[model samples]
Target chain A: MEKTVVIPTDFSIASLNIVKSYVSMQPANARLNIILLHGLHQSDSIRSLLFYSKHRMMEELCSKEFKEACYVLKNKFASQIKTMKSDLFSGFTQSAFNQYTEANNIAEVCLPVLYNPKFKNKNSFDLLPYIKASKLPVEMVGSEVDVPMPEKGKVAELFFNRVSVS
Target chain B: MKMRIQIKTTLILLTAFLSIILMFSGFVYLSVSNYSYEDFYKLLEIRAVTTAKVELDQEGGSQEMIALRNEFFEKLPQEKDRYYRISPGESFKNEAEELGVPISFFNEIVKEGKSEYTKNSMFYKGIRYKSKQGEYVVIASAQNYFELHHSAYLRRTLVFAIIAAFAFSALIALYFSRYVFRPLRKITDRVKEISSENLHLRLDNNSNNDEMSDLIGTFNNMLDRIETSFETQNNFVSNASHELRTPLTAIIGEADVTLSKIRTTDEYIETIKVILDEAETLDRKTKALLFLAQTGFNGKTQKFDKLRIDQLLWDVKETIEKINTNSRIHIDMSLLPENPVKLKIKGNEQLLHLALSNIISNACKYSNNNVVNVSIGASDQNVFIIVKDHGIGIPEKELKYIYDPFFRASNTLKYEGYGIGLPLTRNIIRIHNGEILVSSIVSQGTTVQINLPVGKFEE
Candidate 1:
């Protein structure tokens, strides 16, 4: 049976790198499914554009920096990816994520341990506390960089490791 | 050396302040240390959970886990003693020697789910983590280095703060005590300067209207009374000497005249009678002077007993009549109370008799065979004796001076008196805690009233 992993994303390059690094580190010939989820706090116009028409909204989503990130993921890991977006007001983010995992039969939840500039001293995943509290087995993947975000027009260092949780 | 009030007050205030500061510092130290330990324990729990996630994930090898541990967690010097163990059963092989943890301590952690303690200045926290693979116990310990260093810094800062606060408090107390007692010191200096020669001088009270001003005002009033008393005493001594010398001069002059020549039996007898009369006057004046001196010196030495004032008045009347058979003393007992206790007074009987006789005889002597009215009355709190005379009455201007020893009315030069009677009577009545009131009208009459407190006696 193919193993499925759930990943929450904010559509940023750093988030995309986290998913790519996690998938590439897996053993070769091991069939895996990756779900990229976006929990959105969208305005009425954006919500209507996405819900009312799919093709137009898809074109809009493919226009900006998000298009480059999605394009990179497709070229690298073709036919092994799925993407979904949800409005935050419809349900709690954690509950929605849990339901999505259950429906997809996800083997584990993979969370990106992104650095927050405000908390410069701590070097841990942003979602580490939530994943530890959750019932599901979750892995926090991140790199060790003193700075969280890359300089303008520069790429951040990418490394991946699974965090152990009790 | 005796401690000043300022120093005493400052020390007391500083002691109290230091006690409170010490207590507060202790409480803060205890609370901060406790919070630090609790926070450290929470960090250890997070470390253990993160370690389990990396080691048991099945996807990441030990090299990746080690790399992640190196990247995120800082290695402690005592890291060898910190470790986690997983077992399939309730018991596991002893790892105490390797982990430097007691076997019993591990058992306690497994049974209780969590355990925390401190030994040799190092804090240890252990937790049991249950998973599908097996139950695992994670025990972590390290020296409380950060907490101890922080606490030491805190202790030094608190010590300096307490010392500074006490020093400031002592200075403040000294200033406060001096400010508070400034008025008392001023009054003391002013009082020290006053003497009998300058009894008229008074303290300056033009400052704040507080208790200090009241004390100064009261002292000034006392000085006024003392000055008046001194003036009266000076007058009494001069007058008494003149009065005593008059009778002595007359007795000596008559004796010299009688001894200068011999005469017939009738002539000698007449000369002797004159000498006897002058001697009797001298003896009477001397006795009155003696009584006045004794009453002034030791009024308390006289024994006192309860005596009815009316009976005392009757005795005076009898004594006066014996002295002057032709003198009229009318006793008016109409106003006397039915209850004899109301007329009772506490006094030495001899002094009361002497005071009454002096007043009664003076009334008869001054009235010149006129009816000398003696009235006895009683009130709820006192017995009143009124002696009324209608002879040569005293001048109104001399009424206040009547109680002075040897004081005499200017119009009473022809009256036979040494002027010691009223003053002696006043002193006697005063020692018995009674009052003497005299009201007189020139050429009309004089009235003397004596009020004595009603005496209490057993049934």
Candidate 2:
């Protein structure tokens, strides 16, 4: 049986480091299916909700650099990784998360220990709280290799600078 | 034989509108039907639970409580109630048959709290009520008369509305199409009134920046081009005839004067020389005119071959040297591409030779035998040829008309030319898909730049 792993991502290149660390700990002969999940709020308009499409979301969400990075990772782990695909989790409720996990047959949730999810667009939100509250076993992978994260909004940067200087 | 655009547009609009109205009506009917079904089922379920509470919970089926329940709620059409006493582990197969429902309905009500079934506009709501007396299955069945009659009315109304909407939309579509296409019809009528005789007539271009105005602007631009080219053609014909007639008149006059009386051999020889010179000029003019006409067509009379542009330039230089020995022309090949394939282009060698030779010879003629520098260069997409002459350049005001056949600059009257060379060269270059740009300053020089697409190498 293939062990499918779900990793919540912000679509940055650094997010893949958690996936890399998780894969490194797995058995060499184990077959793996990697699902990179992103939290995207569905359109509130009835017309858009009626005609919702995930393929369109993927095109709008995935950047060129992010796709290239995923391609490189897939190739680098071709021996153990059977398939790699991205999916959107649009629900905000815990039951919805449970349904998503059940639908995808997710065995476990892997996340970075000290990671803050980045919203690529206005419709995106933090999915970590839902994942944390779910019944699935959550494994926290340490970002000990020090992946460079992009800076957030100016307010957070100002707060950080003041605190560090003081 | 063909339908008019206005009719087609109206039909298209009507079809789109009808489809939208039909879809909207269908959606409304489906939702209303769904709402009636759910509402009837909920009402039946409430009645079943209330009756179960009264009969099972009250001591011995109280008549007063039933009367009170009846007084508060309106009676549903053909309402009936059934209660079955439950025995542990006893299959309800017989009860299912008696109730005219599948056994799954009983099993669902037993497992889940309640279940509903529908058959022929009749709704059945079954509930499992556990009271102090015992566990009982109470099912309330009713005919949804309101739903049955209201749906029939709704269906009739929807069909009538759809038909009425179709007719109304068709009328609106016709009017809208007429309003939209009125200007187009006017433009068409105006266009029909214009002919080659009245090429200057243009449609009125209003100030609106809509599609109609764009079309009018485009049509007006087309008319401008037609009028300009027509004028050029007329000018070319008259100029060519005059240029041809001048030499013919000279030859005829000289011959007539010479033959008027007998004269000495030297005098006869002098007369023949003058006639020969005139005939030679006429021959040159006729040949140049013929070549100009031939090159005017786009690759009609010529066969294109992939030839190296540098080699073609060299051939043209050799031909020019042979024609005018005193004409000093230099070919600069310093900018040649390392890949020789970049230097290749698809062109007719003969026409190309004619074109390049014309430019060089003119340079020699106009510059009074000054050295002309011809350089060749290539980029990834195109090859460029630059020909420079340190000659008495064309006047600034006359540069635009230099390509007109038999149009010569004022200062070029001393130079022997019928003004056919530049126009012929331009035609040849155009047929080869090359651009020619001539920039000149009087008494200094003229530079002609020719840019042609580089030929791709096929496997």
True contacts kept of each: 0.00, 0.00
Compared with the true structure, the alpha-carbon lDDT of candidate 1 equals 0.64
Worst 10 residues of 1 chain B by lDDT: B79-88
Which docking band does candidate 2 fall into?
A: incorrect
Q: Evaluated with TM-score, which candidate comes out highest?
A: 1
lDDT (Cα) of model 2: 0.77
The per-model DockQ list reads 0.00, 0.01
| B197-272 per-residue lDDT for model 1 (tens digits) | 8876899879788888889889987775566455435556654564456546666776787778876788778767
Model 1 bad stretches (over 4 Å): A1-166, B4-17, B35-82, B86-113, B117-122, B140-299, B315-331, B353-374, B387-426, B437-449
Q: Cα miss at B204, model 1 (Å)?
A: 11
Q: Per-residue lDDT of A1-166 in model 1, one digit per residue for the tens?
A: 3687766544344555667666666665556676654443333576665666544534543334344334434434443444422212123457755565577776877765553312111221243333345577877676554331111111111111222111
lDDT per residue for candidate 2 within B193-227, as digits (tens), equals 99999887999977599999999999997786566
With candidate 1 superimposed using the best TM-score fit, by how many Å does residue B258's alpha carbon deviate from the native?
Answer: 12
What is every candidate's alpha-carbon RMSD to the true fold?
47.6, 24.0
